[model samples]
Target: MNMATNTPLTDEQSTEAAIQRAGKTAPRVTLMDIEAVVTSEFYFTASDGVFGASNYRPISDRSGVALGLLTFCVLVLRNGFTVTGESACASPENFDAQIGCDIARKNAREKVWALEGYLLKQRLHVVE
Candidate 1:
């Protein structure tokens, strides 16, 4: 009589195989990179909108825009927004400070779509 048997690989061996496979493949762009691009574009847009057509007190507008950008960045970063990326809208805490929760939610939804479009046009893919 002949019997077929299966043997399981050790964890160390499986890990080593995964590492080797990873090393041989081209580095893939991650969702984090897409998030960074979105963040940059958001700030750039805000800055340009504030200063692009201003002649009087351009400095004041620039300063206000900068402060707003920094506040947004700090809020997002400190609150673990990057980990959720475009899904931050689903969290109530994200808009807890806003005067109108409904408006905040709507804006967040729009932002996700806009950011996704920007990333797609830039040839960036979000890793699942």
Candidate 2:
């Protein structure tokens, strides 16, 4: 006939009671609310790779470094060649006849030079 003896509140109930008491006595932020705010502004976008919208396109498949160097040259000579700022290095079609072939050849030469330097260093550091 005694409800208290029949079913006593478990530790969880005691914990909840303590929490409610603390809530009433003090103003405090919960950990869960802090976590929610921390995670709210997080994001993921598909354009995170090297060839993202921020980078140049028509990039060389052989070497990304070479492509980046070529893109730099394209940007530098763009104004003189009448290629617009927005179109610089982003679109090959924007490259004027004077700059297109020269840019491509320069990029290829840069790649070759880099490879040669790497090979020279390797040879210099041979164990024997």
Provide the clashing-pair count of each candidate structure: 0, 0
User: Which 10 consecutive residues of model 2 have the lowest summed lDDT?
Assistant: 78-87
Mind giving the per-residue lDDT tens digits that candidate 1 earns over 28-127? Answer: 3333443454432222223344455563333356465342332122113222443121212333344332433334333443455465556565664555
lDDT value, residue 56 of candidate 1: 32
TM-score of each: 0.22, 0.26
Candidate 2 per-residue lDDT, tens place, 1-128, comes to 22668877644356556799776644333333222222112111112234576665545554553343333222222122212111124444463533644554345334434444565567667944
What value does the lDDT take at residue 74 in candidate 2?
Answer: 21
Model 2: how far residue 25 lies from native, Å: 78
Clashing pairs in 1: none
Error of 1 at 2 (Å): 58
Candidate 1 segments exceeding 4 Å error: 1-99, 124-128
The C-alpha stretches of model 2 lying farther than 4 A from their native spots are 1-94
RMSD of each: 16.1, 25.5
